[model samples]
Structure formats: C-alpha cells, structure tokens
Target: MKPGFWIAPEGAEEPVNIFPIGEEALDASHKGLTASGALAKLASLDSEALARSCPRAVELLSTIAAAIGAQTAGAPTQLFRLEGLNDLERRLIDDVLGEGEVAGVVALPDGTLAQIQESVLAGIWRVRLEADERHDYVEIGAVPEIVSRAAADLTASDIAIGPVPEGTMNALPVLAEIRERALSWRPGQRSQTINFTLLPMSPADMGFLQQTLGNGPIQLMSRGYGTCRVLATGIRHVWSVQFFNAMDTIILDTLEVGGVPVVALAAAEDFEDSAERLTQIIEAYFT
Candidate 1:
C-alpha cells in the first residue's frame, strides 16, 4: 500500500497551530524489512537513534516523496509538525526548494508553533524564486533590489516644474512671443490664441502660482507645450517682455500685460548649499 498524508485549508475558527505527525502513523509508514521499510524502522527510533541512521533517513525521505506523489496527484503540499528541525535546517530547505510552490512539511519549534503559523499567514516567510539551470530549481530569497530602484527612478522622472514661467509678462506680448516661438519651433503652422488673466500678487497668489506652474494642465494651449497665466507686479510690471529659447518653441505664452515677474529669488539665494540639490532634482526630470 502506498503511504500518504493529509492536508486541510486554514480556517478562521480553527486553532492556529502546527500539528505534528502522530507516533502511530510514523511507525506504520516506516515498519518493513525492505529499503522502503526503513522509514518505519527509523520511526521506531528516538531522535538520537534516527540521527545516527543517515542511510535510514535518506531512504525515509524517498519513501515520503513517493507517498506524497501517490497521494496528492502532484499538487503542492506542506507538512506541518511542532517539533522537528532547527532554524538552519529550515533555511536550507527554503534555499533548496524548487519554484512553483512545492509542498513540504514544517516542524515548528516546540512552544512557538501557533505563533509561527500566524506569522506565516501574515506573509513573514514569503520568499522569491530565481532561475537556476544546474538543478532545474529556483533559489528562494528576498525581493530583488532592481524592482525598488526602478520604482524610485520612475517617480523621480515624473516630477516637473511648470506650465508657468519664472517671470511675468503682459497678456498680449507674452501670447505673441509664445506664438512666434511656436511658429519658429514648428514652421508653417498658424498660431492659436490663448486666454490670459492678471491677478494681484500675494502669498496666496504665490502659492496658487506655484501649484499651477508646478503641476497643472496646460497641454491644451499648444501641442508640445503647456500654457499658464503669469502675475506681474511691482515696478517691472510696465515693460514689454519676450521669452528666449533654442528651438523657438513657445514654452511660455502670455502677453506682457500689467504686471511684473515677481522676483523673489529668496528661495534660490543659498547658491552654494542648494545648487547641487536643485541640479539633481532638475536632472532627474530631464534625464
């Protein structure tokens, strides 16, 4: 007769604990004279006796594998027991196991069986598998570092500064400059008219401008660029303004109306201390 084991899905009401194999089952499985019977003989022995019988242990493992295969129809399974191997042995088992959820037995450390089960349910022992050609097996370990690096890179890359430019200009001149730039960037296309607004400069205004320029919608204004309204206040508010760029792409589009580009370079004042950090931030987005 083929040897076999049983499995039960975890249940909410069921007591959370590791159950060990009973002596009777062990004895029955290990009891004959042939090589297959070695497991039974080993079961009759105490841990010390079994420890001395390496050949018997090996045979027993084979028998258990056969029994599990015959019983489980090749499905993954794990055997849980309350007193078996030490921590090193458990780590070794995890290291050697194949990919795809191989089923096996776990002999929990005596008094901590219940706690261990709870930990397992909480995913404390989860391991990832890596491809290996030698043994046609996968080595299990912690999550790879590349995944985390990729996520961080993507987040840093997505950050952007503006649809709003640094300086402010009049509605008409800014719009005209933007259109001119756009035409220069992509010739033969007619410039589109963009609406502009002028508002008073205040802390709240600064905050709103920061938000709108930092992360806002302006893609509707131009195909490759976004549009933003600038608030020009104070003395510089009266002059006509023009934006200079390499490709003539109208990055900033708004006419120089009745305001000045609020020049508060206070944030960028500590050049030595902040230059490198700002450079890194800017480079992260562009590169």
Candidate 2:
C-alpha cells in the first residue's frame, strides 16, 4: 500500500483517504461483457430470410471478418456503405449488429455531427461518415478514424489564461499544466492524467476549468457496471474523463492531455475477438 498524505498544520484535516469503494461496490462495477456471454444472448434468427434473401448482408459479414483480419494486421479501417439497402437487408443488418457498450457522437468531416455506435461485437462500429442525409456505414477496426480526427480537429491549440476568479483554488495552475502538456504532446507519446479527486478543488475552480476549456462536440459513453463518459474539451489534446458509479457519483475525475483517451477505444484483441465471434454467429445462424 502506498502511504502518503499532505503535509498540513496540526488539526488541519488533511482528509486524503479517498478510496471509499466497498467490496460490493467494486463487484457491481465489473466489466460484464464476456464473449461467450454475448454469444448466448442471440435467440433463433429467421434462418430462411438470411439464407434466401439476405445474401448481401451475409457477404458484408464475411467482408467485415476479412477487414477485421486486416485491421488486426495493422491495416486501416474498412468501411462498408449501408446505402441502398432494402428493408429486409437493413433490418437484418440492424438485428445482427445490436448496440454494444460504447456509443458516442463525433463530428463528421464537414463539421456536421454523426452518431457512432459500437456493435455488440467489439471493434465493429456503425457511424454516418457523410454530412446530411443518411449515409451510414459499418467500420471494422479498433476504433473509427472519425472519432480521433474529430477530437484532434476540434481541439483548439490556444488556451487563454485569464485572471483567476475569486474563491477559485489551484485551477489556474492546473490549467497551465494542462496547456503546457497538451501543446507539447505528440502522436504516439504517453499522455498525462491529472487526478482531481485527490486535489483540493473548490466549486469555483471546477467552474473556471470548464469555462476555460469549453466543451467539444465529441462525447462518448462506455457502459459497464457504471459509465465512463469521455468528453473532449475545446482545448487541443485535452479531454475530461470521468467515471461515474451506479448512483451517478463521480468515482474518478481527471483531465487528460494527449490524443483520444484509451478508455474509449477498442483494442486489437477486441477486433480479433469480434471477428471470430461474429463469424461463429453467422455460421451457426445465417449459413
């Protein structure tokens, strides 16, 4: 155990023992997503519909698997256009790729917004790439490229330092550190996370921090026993990542300086597992 506390004067109330999560609380916040568990949730699909009419959907699944393989081998994401799908085809695709644990909104290239939802299988994402008029597509990758691009593009490099408002404590220094780290951060570099739960932050400080780094359009939710909401601030390479418990209490809060935080992105192992699991589902039901 790491034993450390703030050096304060006598009777100064250095209450820094912050981890109050009980055993039951910890148990409640587990990552309940299991590959086998996901497989068992599928009831009997309409075999006849998929076999007779949904040939294109079947081809798309196979293509997704192939693309996932490429992605595992470090290839760029593969996009399958969902344009011109008939009712049955679209429904089949939708029913098969039920919503997963991660969902978010990202800005499209044209500055419009698009909803990005992960499929039940990890690393498979449904997002509208184009702006205006439904042009949705499925991307098989660790994460959709648009998510990172939007985060990067929308993050303003210049963060202005204003006079510290009255009653605010340490927010200015924190902002300065964030600005310095964010401006110097580069791709493939290790990011820094400043934990606020351990800091002495006044309400005014928090307000000032939020006001200085205005919210960006990129917002994502990764659901588990609770939810980890990743919000991109207007400042470049700055993200506000907060984890809330079942009762909506923020168990952890931090500002991250770098590219998109890793909590929001699926991993290569996720892509591989998703590809395999979906292939198994297809073979068992659609074939």
Candidate 3:
C-alpha cells in the first residue's frame, strides 16, 4: 500500500488509529474443514436440519438471484437478515461466498460492535452485529449504511472557533467555506465532496485547517493499491480523507463534506454483477 497523508499521521512517526483487515482475516479458515467439505456436509444434511439450514441459505441465495435477475433492480437499498442460523452455518455461507477486498470491525458509540465485510461479489457486504442474538445481514450498495449512519452529526451550534496561532491567515477562508457547506447539507441529498487539494495552500494553511476542524470519533481505513484513511473531523459533515501509496507516502489529500468518498463507494454495477456471481456459486455447490 502507498503511504501518504491518508495512511499515517502527518509529521508523526506512528499511525493514529487505523484498523486495516490484515491478510490473516482475509484468508479463509479451513480449521477443520475446507469450503468444499462444508458444502458436502451441507448437501448430506437430513431433511429436518436441511429445512433449517437450506431455507436460510436459499433465502440469501434468492436475494442474490433476484439482485442479478433485475427483480430488485429498482428496489431501495436492501438488508436481509439470516435468522435462526448458527455460527457454523453462517461460516459455511461465508466460505461459499469467499472474502472480498475489505472488511472492518467498528465499535459504535452505543456500544454495538458491528463487523462489515465485502463479499467476493463486490458491492455485496456481509454485516454482522454482536449482540445477545447475532444479527447477520447481506447488504448491496456503495458502502454499508452503518458507516454513514455512525458518522458524527454536526450542526451550526456545534461549530466553535478557538484561538489560532500567529500568521495563520489563509485557514479562515477555507474553514468558513467548509463550515457553510457542511451546515447546509441535508440527509439523503447527493454527496457534495469539496476537494481542498486543488487549492494551493502552505503547510501552515493545512495545519490550521486540521486544527480548526478538530477531530471526530470515527476512524476508518480501506485498502486497494495502498491504503486510504477516512477520518471524521469533529465538525459535522466534514471528513479528512487521504490516500497513500504502497511506500506509505501520501498520494492524494482532500477533505470530503459528505457521507463518504467515491473511492470507498462501490459502483452500482458491482451489485448488479454480484447477483449473477452468487448464482454461479450456489450452482457449484448443488452440482
């Protein structure tokens, strides 16, 4: 992964709080059985147990099928919960689907631990919640709803300026513009991302900008070529997004004033293709 402003703290030796799903997490676990072994076990299940397992698998498979078949083409974002399935069954399902590029385990303010994993099928995500009863869901979209929903909610009243150091002239204008854009945003509106990188600003200007915006609670990391770090600045709707190269050098630096960045968003076509891909997966097991 490339390293830059996105992957690490600027001018700092160590990364702040980046939770990257490592290779170990992405590697399929064949502790006692392989994916095919699980499939064979599933196929040999007796009628009553199959009634329990197959229904859940088929329900998920059906959603994947419909998602591919155009039946859900125009449907609103869908979240399907797999009720009454044990962890083993769920693990089997995951093994069948395989793992995708990114996965994350986030702890929300309300103390809910939400784990989100992109399926091998791109836009399709497997979201799991660790509560009294496990809640497992399959979601297809740009990013999971939990991420956007968990972002810090900011309002005008929440904006307060602190004393700035001497010679910090350029930051005020940029800060004001960001404040205005952030305050005007409404939920469900199209994402409005402002690229601060295009502007010619000095290090002092950038420093002042970060100091003024403050820091928010949420910190997210996604990996592709290198890594991209998305930080929720203390102010509402304002996010510090940075992309890094494999060398850990910051390649692109910008502030996004919306839900999430497009780079982190899965293109709609991904979900469309995921449906057909999932169908083939299910067929392979049955065959």
Top lDDT model: 2
**Candidate 3 whole-model C-alpha lDDT, 0 to 1:** 0.62
What would the per-residue lDDT of candidate 1 be over residues 1-287, giving only the tens digit for each residue? Answer: 11001112236332111233332322232122322232233335453433333333333333333332232211222232212444433332222111111111222123211100001111111222223112111111111122112212222212122454444433234434433443243212332333222322333333333332222110000011222222211111121122214553333333332212211111122222222332332233212
Each model's TM-score? 0.16, 0.82, 0.73
Q: RMSD (Cα, Å) of candidate 3?
A: 5.4
lDDT of 3 by residue, 1-287 (tens): 32222333558565544333343432332133333554556566553554455666656666666764453423455677767777756665666565565665555666666767776666777787766344778776677778766674434225566777676656777778787878787656666665655666666666667667766655555665567767777777777887777886677778877766666666767666777766775665533
Local distance difference test, candidate 1: 0.24
lDDT head-to-head 2 vs 3, winner: 2
> What TM-score would you give candidate 2 relative to the actual structure?
0.82
Q: What ranking of all candidate models by lDDT puts the best one first?
A: 2, 3, 1
Global lDDT of each candidate:
0.24, 0.71, 0.62
